[model samples]
Target chain A: MRKRDLSQFFKDKRVILLIILILASVISISTIGIQEGLDLKGGSLLQLQLEKPVDQDTMNVVTTVLDKRLNIYGVKDVKVRASGDQIVIVEMAGVTPEEIERLIGSPGKFEARIGNESAEPALTGSDITNVDMYEITGTSWTVPFKVSPSGAQHFAEAAEGKGGEKVYMYLDGKLIDENPPTLSPELANGKGATELTVTGGANTVEEAEAQAMAVYTVLKTGTLPVKLTVIGSNTISAELGEQFLNGAIIAGLLAILVISLIIFIRYRRPILVIPIIITSVSEVLIVMGIASIIHWNIDLSAIAGLIAAVGTGVDDQIIITDEVLGKNTDNTKRRKTRTRMSVKNALFIIFASAGTLIAAMLPLAYVGFARGSSGIGTISGFAFTTIIGVLVGIFITRPAFAKFLEIFIK
Target chain B: MLEKFMESYKLLIIIPMIVVILSVGLIAFNGLNEGIELKGGSIATIKLNEPIPSPVLENQLKTALNVDEVDILNNNGNDVTLEIGTEVNPASFASALSGKGQVISYNSIGPVLSDEALGQVYWAMLFAFIFMSITVFIIFREIVPSIAIILAAASDIIIAIGGMSLFNIPLSIASVGAILMLIGYSVDTDILLTTRVLRRREGKVVDRAKEAMKTGLTMSITAIASMVVLYAVTVIFIPQASTLSNIAAVLIFGLLADILTTWFMNLGMIRWYMEWRT
Candidate 1:
């Protein structure tokens, strides 16, 4: 603790990286202002624009379908109403863009009619088993989908005796394909076809792929109604959100104080403890920076993820400290070599632990990605933040911590 | 050095095993409640204009909404969390609570996306286990030490879930996140112990274990301290967020469970394995 060699510390790449990141994070935070999620912000709002202006009746149908779809996802307290003939406004609290966008983004309604524009779709989306990935050729696209046997039966009955009549594909009452191929002569008498492709031609390959993707998405989501594209989405937090955030902040600060006290007690030296705390704090700040840069809302689950990441960061710090000082405090001629060996060993444990932590976190992140990371920024947000925090710890902060110990612990 | 008692310490592995068995039983019999996040429902908080007991409020809500099922998730003096059933109409809800209380907030959560999400939860758990096992195996490159570490981690999670079931902490997204955090902490201490006890030969096995314990316990207590503060803060300051409360509570349990799993269960096995190997 005697010497203050500032230049060497600055020269260390680990310290340099840590300092740069912490500075960047501070800038990112002040500029972007850490994105508070629904739990902190209260609730969110989403605006959906219908493909075309429809009747009040059609709008009602659209709103009702959207409401019921959210209900299916077990979300209640959602107000799905039409802003106008063309706009449907959905207001809710504690949900994410990913959750709602995945739920209501695509109008799940898919219908096939043999004779043409009719309320009675011979086959509904439920009839389809799965929507295969789109296949693109030049400026044409086809989304192949297979139907259940019963769906095939229903299709046969609809297409019966309609020889040479073109069958139309409709998604949310809009024509998926205009000038569709006429019924095959073999199928003209009502031969059953389980597999069907919604073929579309566009001026450009991108357009064709986009058209095919729209079909694929709608088919995959079970069903959606009245093609509504998300135009705007945001949420406001409840007063409870503010209260919860304050509580979390207070609790977090108190926790940090407790952790610092423990670290101070363990090392019994401000020189060692200060850097440990600073390293962890910087790690968290950098994580918050990355999160803000990516605009990951800081929700309850996300907070949990942050804690999980930082928790391991502290654990690794303890491991490094113990290993570096363990059984080799004597001033042997081999002190530097032993310290290097200890740092290397500590790095091994840090990397191994980081690997498993990330591995454990990946599933929750994957689930959050798949679905259920709804309201108040649930599952996946936690994993996302946790993964980011761990990566920051291992790559940036952990090495800096070791470098700090290497410099002064002798 | 406590070496005399250390011989019998190898038997301590069964303590966590028995705890795990009992935890499994508790979970099986009680069954973990999947929070409304997965099960279709909504949470509404009403700020009381007048002082009302939680049960009284629940009764009023049941009659007002004409729904027989209403749960009082939390009662934080003025802010009472009303765990009302799904499909709530604000108009009716307002009318239902007109004079009784003011509507602070209402969130009606329906069921999660689908069965696929539920399936994904299981898959996620499986993958976490598989990956953790692989990582431990790679680290130790020894089957027994690696498997023991993974088993301890698994047991910590199972016991934590059992603690949840026992304590009525519902399995929600928030609590699941807590469990995930616990998984990391559990593996952390185990890894610390295993690495120090098995890989490092500078000190006697028991001396190395005691040293690892000192470091591991410090890590655990620091974590536990935070969770305690968090839980206390959530309960006292922001009781309306029952979901937030779940995260803190579950994390506390998982961390506490990790201590036992790591120090006793995993440590005993490692010591025994070391002795048996010798």
Candidate 2:
């Protein structure tokens, strides 16, 4: 049978592939879509150093709890993981440092006592207005806390019960009880008392004051059941991250330009240029889209992965170009055979190479590889996007190359 | 010169026999340099304010931690990497070392993490094989070339990994990436050779294969050069980047071996099969 219009070669299958791709591109753009990386959309990165002596088991539990808390706090695209023992890295998209500090740093260690009115009186350390480490002329250091007017009234009323029996001072409901008097009349006005003293079993007056200060902050917040301590706090300012991001963008553009120029010089035609350029651009876009969709925080490691992908993708495009131009056997309408062979080879190599990378990355992103959800998502996002780029190359860019080759490649 | 060169059977049989022997030996002894990620261990990075003698710090740490299996890798004399494998209380060790010098960083993964990482590596290799075979079969419509290419790619990776193990180089996440990278490189060269032969060019099939090799070799060499430079930079300049540097080293060796196995051994076997079938 005679070959049916070899010149109009890319008619049936090629057209169908193009329609599918165009539809996909349109759908992706229009929909409630993926979340772009922190690099594209700004976010907060908080690095906390746990107090020494914390093990991986404790860190893991803390990480899980923090993740749950952040989710509860309405921080979307949150990543909570341990970098190692002692440092937990938290990445929260659209969260401020102050919010993170507030959530993670709750100093709610207090001694509270139950009264008739309520189970416990909420008294903050700050409520104990004055803590003094005073020394009498010949005595050792003595520390005392002076209550506010409201606290004084409550103290007086409690002391009146049971003949000047000690009204216990509590922090977070812990009892710090001391007897003030043996008579109700004596306790009522402190008339028989030498001096009213609120003290802890601490070594010196300084220790007492420090302990009081620590308790004061937690009581002031009045938050309960959530015990959090800020061991370490750091913030990467939005402005600096933005400047770094702009520099990265410029670097990426320059890399693409240099690479395209090199490919053009080596291949010496616009035929190869079209596919290489398209695939390269599509790789970046698809990676960004995947990062957005997967909510991967595109950090510096991700940027490195992208640059590496561009290099690999360019090499693949060159192979396709070389296959088309340098090796065509069919004499009668050889261009058709060449185009067919090139696309077939391009598709094969792209699929094979991308298959391996995807296989490797899928596991990295899965439950098995890195226990934490940080590195895997970012690094794997780059791989996943590049693989998508290859698919896009198969459908859009390679066919685009075919059309260009038909026009430009003699 | 041509007649004399053609008599060299060393290129045909001996080299492959050597490769097989070397690959087997390495694979058998691969247990020695089992990756830190695979074997549960402690990897510590200590950054000093200034360069210090390795022995002084090494001895201090070794005596303090009571660790004998410690490697004091002075990275550019500025950073020291100590990998401790024996189980010791990490906090106690860090505290003990902190007295001598500041402990900049340390990471410890339980046996669970290592087991998980190994499992993932296994699945990744399996998925790669299945995916490559299916895709190649669709594109080529010929199972023989596809199978040969896949086998060649696998052989290249195994040999690369074996070589790394034999050389006492730690198999890392980067090396895993390197193995995957070689799969692409190996298949590319095999496909290039196959296409040249299938085109039925004006010259003899063998002659065209040689011509394809010229181009394929150039590409491989360039790639090897780049990877070599990358390896050097990773190893020499970036001490912390163990994974990336190790991967570059594997790729350099794998791509170099691939030029021979993929382009020649596998390509030769495929052509022989095709001729035999016809």
Candidate 3:
């Protein structure tokens, strides 16, 4: 047979279509990019269970309060969503588990009291109108706040005869600042002072700043109505997460290389192995592109799923290649008829295998959804990515690969 | 020569059956290790400025924290993970290790959440198995081949669990995902073998079997190679990704088990059925 024309091969509609699809996927991946999960990006995930199952309104209020608190505390990229009936899943990037637990774990009730501890709180967080942090000196930082008219009047009355007496600051009913500044005689005798500064006890500017920020956040968002129990929390470091991302990419490339080597050893024909590798790679790209489009977080498990999908993709391509190339000594019919029959048989096996694979992964995805962000929920990304990969293999890449073989094998 | 081998198909099938039985026995006697993700506990990953021996760290943590169980896992030279039986104050825990390292990650799961997660894992596995079996049955529309495929899948999982038990790998969410993926992979080779031997008539029975083996073995070998690469990369370079490493490890075991079950047990069953019909 004459040498096949490479230009003509590229000119084929199927080949062009495959190239276009692959290009689209690459573009999507580069532009949209896959979202990294908290495990892949240094972050914290807290699964909070409320004390009692409340109505949707109460849950909404709780989520809103938590979101505001995290934002005020300078935690960017905070996601607070209610999962199931009583669970609230809070995910924040670039925050430590200790920081999150301290910030959100509290009911956040802030109160200031004078000498008469038996009387009601002189000023609560709800009474505060504004809070701001200021640098008093090189190393000193204080958070000042303004109270409402009623709150100011209450403070004046509480501090009238309580000059030089200490004012205690409380958070969540616990005495947080026992040495708060005493009420001065001027403030007690003069008009009710609406503004006061609370100096955070710190030896350094950075420490004071952090303390001031925490106080500001608490006073701003006030307290949550319902109590929360931290059922689960995961924190990953930024450096470690970056290492995992790099390692995953290297592993993926190495996997491709090794798989290609195996295929080459088995087939010993570059014509067949090249297409197999390209098809497998395309399947992966398409899966990732779809992930980007759907905003799926590519966590550790998802990466595993991607590898598994590609592994199975290679298996299916091998089956297709063997079927198309298997020769019979006694050919009783035309070559087309024999090839058609073999290809049909191969497709049947591929479909059957794909069906079973889909069946197996379906539960992982759906059950994870039903249970929310629990243990199994972490692996749901794996299941979903695998399903996408398998579906893409069967529907798009495998058929294109078969067509390539049908054109070139003869 | 092929006929002589066909005569002992029953005996050949018994080998894998015995392995499956032994695997089941192993699992029953030595229950699988459950990770903190499944069992409620605290895991603190600390990155040390200087390397500390795992034993020393474990002993220190146990003494300082007064915890019943403290398991220290080293992550190359970068970090070490400590698993504690009860929740402790994160600040205190960090302070206790301040002299040696810094805590990079801390995860804790309460008992209630863990129990709920464990229930979900069980349900996912059960549903996956049932659905996959149904799909296989529907595809073949034949009793013997379909049953062979399902049995092969089960044997692969059982053998994988046995391997994990022997290796002391815990049954975490990641490993469970690997097992579920194994169900898919095990069926791939079995389906290919069955289709080639039963549905096609291009060659003699033994020749067709041999041809299917060539194809199926290539598939299994390629998968095994990729998994090996993945497993090595994660273990050496990304020690923090225990999830990926565990998943790769379980897949490696399951794929190896699949080769045996598919070639010996599944091929033997089909050969016997074909011979009996003739």
Docking class for model 3 is high
Of the candidates shown, which would achieve the greatest DockQ relative to the real structure? 3
TM-score leaderboard ranking: 3, 1, 2
Q: Could you give candidate 1's per-residue lDDT for residues B123-241 as a string of tens digits? A: 77788788778878877899888988888888988998999999988887677777777778888888888988898878688888888899899889888887788788878887766
Off by over 4 Å in 1: A2-4, A45-238, A372-377, B112-116
The TM-score that candidate 1 achieves is: 0.74
Interface RMSD of 2: 6.5
Fnat by candidate, in order? 0.57, 0.07, 0.93
- Which one is best on lDDT? 3
lDDT string, candidate 2, B1-278, tens digits: 32233234245334644685688787786654756566656666665677768777767768888878777654556667777765344455656666455444444444544565667666666776676666666657787777777777777877787678777778654466557657666766777666666645567666666656655765575466556555555455445545545666787778877876765566657666656678
The local lDDT score (0 to 100) that residue A145 gets in candidate 1 is: 88
**C-alpha lDDT of all candidate models, in order:** 0.76, 0.56, 0.83
Model 2's CAPRI class is: incorrect
Docking class for candidate 1: acceptable
Q: What is the TM-score of each candidate against the true structure?
A: 0.74, 0.64, 0.92
